[model samples]
Target: MKLAELAKELHITTDSFIKFIQDFDLELSECISTDFEVKEDFARFARENISFLKNYQKDLEQPKTVEDIAGNISQPADKVAEVIRKEKPAIYENGVYRSSVSSFGVDQKLGGDYNFVYNYFGKRMPLAKRDFIGYRDLFFYISKALDPFANENTTLTDWGIHRPAGIILYGPPGSGKIFWAHKIAQIIGYQFKEIKKYYLGTSFVDGNETSFNDFLLETMKQEKVVLFMDDFDNVMMERTATSSVNSCDEETKEIILHHIDRFEEEELLMVASANTLTGIDREILAPGRFDVVIPVFPPNVQERAEIILYYMTKDLSDEALLKQILEKNNADHLPFWNEISARMKVFSNTMLIDFTQSLKKRIRTQYLKDNSLDIDIKKHLQPALREASAKLTDEYFEQMSRFIKDISVNNYDDFATRIENLKQELQHYRIVEKPRQAIGFTHNSDSK
Candidate 1:
């Protein structure tokens, strides 16, 4: 199961929740043990005595007993009982925990031509169970992407050779499409190799089609390769000066088509991505060629929340922490999580503010409390007031005029101080929000 699913069930941080269950064996412990039940008195004692237990651990410099450390949980036994079904230790494999790794964009082309990876931003949706309206179709799409022949992967009898199904993801830049593909692949345990859709499509051996054809045939013979082609748009559009859109160019297309057919016939998996479908020659991705056409777009709220939880795995995990991380970062949860997981230190809270409408308004309230937004300044900043009052949106952007009204500046030194404060505010916003831009989402306030 995905981490977010478990996190939601337990209402704890992903790291904490996962560690307690999968890593620490707490979840399994309860399943196996029938005799043990936490007593109310015992729970209270544990809660009240946590400070002493911590001090004892500090003094002893080693574990004294299971009860000695109180499961590293400082609250009452009831609290622990509430969070975990029960506490029993189970041994976990060493090296089970690993730091999250980020994939820098990869470059691969179908032939020797297009250099950049085709970009896509797909919605990260939860699995569906019918009764649809508000439910986005991305989950079904992901299931298909994960198992290209998802329906067919269950074949009972062998015909010739059964190559496993793989997928192709193509879409617009900043669409966050490829990331979703990677996540689905991760869930299913497929080794991923991102190919930048670069193809010279330049003729070989006096422009004999055999050169590229032979090369592609050699590649097709390799096993378990997804053959992810990015930017399929550039090569297929017949943009090459070398291959004019003539009959000979059509022949070049044939060589390419033949190899793709070979991969399909042989049951080898291939996923090719393109930003603009029109750029791609229709013959390549036509019905029998690629199995499915999955369109990826920027995340809606639920998908963004799932991604935020995934990224914040290294930081805090619960609703509270998620809210904080979103607010601290000041960007929507998706980009913040994507960026922070890169440098996040494990343990305790990693900062993010909640990007939800309610949470953002709460944050604004906190800001108002922290600094005085007095009546005089409010009177002077009528335009700012009008702008902020313009709608019932959860997002509220206080104008710079309000910022200026509050500051009493006298000369250059004071101005510099104000500038420094402004710099800090802007800096926090950048630290919080820039990653959204990094992963290709627009950095507008609406994104939050």
Candidate 2:
């Protein structure tokens, strides 16, 4: 490109470009020397300008020292940053997880009465707020265990409450164990931590994971309590089904047990959970180690009904029905009542209703120019007839009793009519009447 063209691209006047060129003792044309040469001066011109160019180069290339560089930034930035980093550790990284009141996500509707049921158990309850069964005993154990630790390590903090309990709850998955564990931190409004055990594998500075240990430890010093050592189970998995399934993975269970053995008391209360503490290797579950160990089991029928009632919408009366189902199920350890599943009563009606609407639309589009299935079963059809003779006979019971009495008294035609009415009644139950929801933890025959 021409020297003038280059100057225009640089947003310089030809005069300014000449001044820049003059600093190196070159004319506008001379600055271009041979057109092919990008950065060189003609020999005679360079001989005269060499000293000036060297001085200019020296001025441009001289670098700032460490003190000079530091001075260039806002003053006292180091002190300000140190304060913030110390107050809230630079190591903490936050993420969100989906949790529920009962540990398993409860199927509930928004803006409904059932919402409270989930919330009732969502927050961590304090000594003051907990209403769940066994809470009083758990609190007592925690207080007694922490008495020594609190006496030793706990110092004056802004909040009067001192945490002395360091607990590990291990049980079957989906057994509401973890939810209860984190609720401790949640109850006191403290940060809940899942210790990155990978960080504690060896001395930190080996890599990112281990380095987080240095960060996590510092945060532990400041926060009221945090759940750490995020490895959900270190020992229980060893003897359980998982040890075999996951044997290929790195890290022996010994490392985890070792960490628990060597742990120092911090102000933070640690909470951990696993499926079974029985196999957790005694090293980890030792008295000073876990402080307390509590096990959780599935709710009994009454408890299950309470939970179900909490989620229900229709509030159907079903006392006898519940009795019948419970009596049958109580024979063994049944996991759940399929009859009480949320989708049960709603499906058949929804399917039938949606089916009829689509059928109507198809009839309108395919057959009629004016378009519609003229014979609409969804709207007009009521109940269906009983196919089984036994069911027919059962349906005709009240009428049958009446019929038999009438016949005995010699009224045969009326008896026959009564039998027919009873059969009609039986047909109504088959028509798929809307099932009333059993709002409470029950499947009662009576529509409560």
Q: Could you say which candidate leads in TM-score?
A: 1
Count residue pairs with overlapping backbones in model 2. 22
Per-residue C-alpha lDDT of model 2 across residues 90-133, encoded as one tens digit per residue: 22121111110100111111111333222322232221222332
lDDT by residue (224-301, candidate 1, tens digit) is 455566655554565455545645345545776666656655445666665545445656656556545554433333
- How many backbone clashes are present in model 1? 42
Which regions of candidate 2 fall more than 4 Å away from where they truly are?
1-165, 187-189, 196-212, 228-231, 234-265, 313-448
Candidate 1: misplaced stretches above 4 Å? 1-136, 145-168, 183-190, 197-215, 238-253, 265-267, 305-448
lDDT of model 1, residue 421: 38
